[model samples]
Target chain A: MAKDTMIEELLDAWEETYKKGQLTFWVFLALKESNKCMEEIKEFVERASDGTMTCEEQSLYRNLRKFQNLDIVAYDSRKVSKGPDRKYYYLTTTGEELFKRFVERNIMIFTKESIINLLTQ
Target chain B: MRVFTQRLGQFAISALIFTVAFRYALDLSVGMKSFPAALVCSIVYFGLMFFAGWYYGSKDAVENEIHDIGFRFHFITYVLCIALGYASYFIGWNTEPLRSLNIGAMSWGIGLALHFVFFLFAQKNAIRGYVKEEIFQ
Candidate 1:
């Protein structure tokens, strides 16, 4: 029974790891270069993806919040002239390192080698 | 529950495929006997799985950054253990067959436990990094 519990625990952990939408490399890439708010990230994604990719504000905000929870993303609200303050998101050092590794095998925005260099700094 | 079950099934199927390819690679490399070969194989295998998880896991609308962080945490811990094993072997401290298994196991357990708690509690906090102290302004 103890062994079974351990196994179950392992599965639960894996489930947590395997949860969907946890690897939005494009979103990370957008923020890695500079801190950005939701609109900025969305615009960057669209521009970078050339209209092929778009992340809705709601999804984007939720992703940013989750990343913040992991300490991979950091944010500070900025006041604008016309509206409510917006949260600008950027990759924390930890997030940048993780992004570098994630870029090692996958090509999301830049060449693998170039991205590793850019993200490492 | 349906979503969880569906996710479990998806993960199982993908994991099965990855295992098949990974097994073939190992068989071709060192026949699973040599320690270094096994070690390298495990690293590459897990690394590939990590990428695969990230790739597929990002499909849904809801994001789970904590989950991604957990994956990286375990992967890094595993890599560190492997590096330590290699370093110890080269330094003549021990053989290449993971002489200090307890170190790896203990370190990984500790790191993973800490990672679990950090992410879990981080989600519980009502506030995030953003603040308005008016000092910066």
Candidate 2:
């Protein structure tokens, strides 16, 4: 529960920090990990953080769509089984640059070791 | 919505406190009386946030927040660069000859252009409604 709250806080806390054109850092990071759809991204985040995701499925999809609008990320719909096509998303060049620049800027404060640990497992 | 807003409020308060402490310490050395305290504060704040994101991964809540804050600062800086460039041009300021060629505006405008190309134009078929296409086409 505490972890869930923390996750929620961290995700929502970023709203205050959205100055202009900026998307949430976590969303970018998640996209960078793989070119997965919303559901896959949600599951990945939960597994990565030991089921600590506090936001629901809709929020994840909403963020993805926003990223699409910003041209940071793009999606292609692949054929899924019965119901509908599954959209797979990947970071565009702009998205990659933004994420890279963001990391470079915070390299000193967040520490490489910590980031490595976080991304690796 | 309520919960999200509450969390955002908390983030704002925490950021305010951190800025105050950081500015106070920086003011001791830079002497805000002479130098532009506002400029110094903005620089230091961005420097710290950027440094944090670079050093620490956005694994936890605090680290993640720091990363996003850096993004906000960058986004704002680029916007301000373009805005102030236009402002200076219109104000008919003196220092430089070609006021039209604002370096900040030109360079940052390229950044914005790239944002449009890769993010907007990359996926040509994106705008179509998925459900609509899925059913019709």
Candidate 3:
């Protein structure tokens, strides 16, 4: 039981370190899939990351603004029936290319059979 | 609403500080003919400006939708400082042209030029948005 607790603690620490850098990747991935409103983007990130990652709406808005400034993302304001206009965001061409290069260089390697087998073992 | 008022109050305070310090520094160096004392005043002016910028600029970056706050703040502040420098000279607050310009305007103009270059490169990356019609058509 102590060994299990020890392992759990170690995994928790590892995730804490790893998760900090992963939000940007997850945010980009969510936008890449489809143009989504703020709430939708948050849902996508939480659902896709299997609840391991969560983000506040304020943080997401800040990130979106930064990405917009960098030309990595853009949005269109669509009118909603109930209230004010809602901004639906999507990855820009630059962002898509950036994500492609990032995945090819970093994430694709983990998909190799050798790496996959080693991870499973 | 609360945040907006807080930001407005901060802006008001910053403006007041700049106006008072800028005038005092100009008067000290130009009117008093105390170059060394003016230099100290100028340093204080710069320190206050830089602290206000770096502190609030970083916060503004994440909190506000505006991304070019740093560049804009530096540009506007320096421009106003230089204009005030020239105005002081024209108004006979300073009898010396070179000393007046050298004390504040010229130095800040150079800094503004460098900042402009940074803004150019940073703004260059800002491309056109994703237009649905363009893609569909």
What proportion of the true contacts does each candidate reproduce? 0.23, 0.00, 0.08
Please give the lDDT score at residue B109 for candidate 2: 74
Q: Which stretches of candidate 1 lie over 4 Å from their true place?
A: A1-23, A108-121, B1-137
DockQ for all candidate structures vs. native = 0.09, 0.02, 0.09
Where is the poorest 10-residue window by lDDT in model 1 chain B?
Answer: B128-137
Q: Residues B12-126, candidate 1, lDDT per residue (tens digit)?
A: 4566566555555555555445778767877987897677565555542233322333334344435554555555446544243554656766677787778767755654532
TM-score of model 2's chain A: 0.67
Give the Cα-based TM-score of candidate 1 against the true structure: 0.36
Computed on alpha carbons, the lDDT of every model, listed in order, comes to 0.61, 0.55, 0.71
Candidate 3 wrongly placed segments (more than 4 Å) = B1-55, B64-75, B92-98, B107-137
A1-121, model 2: which lDDT tens digit per residue? 6999999898777754442222255556678888887777777776765654434676566656655755778999999779899899999999899789978896455667877789778
* Model 3 chain A lowest lDDT segment of ten: A62-71
Give i-RMS (Å) per prediction. 14.4, 15.4, 13.2
Error of 1 at B127 (Å): 19
Per-residue CA lDDT of model 3 for A51-98, tens digit only, reads: 989999987887787678567889999999999999999999998998
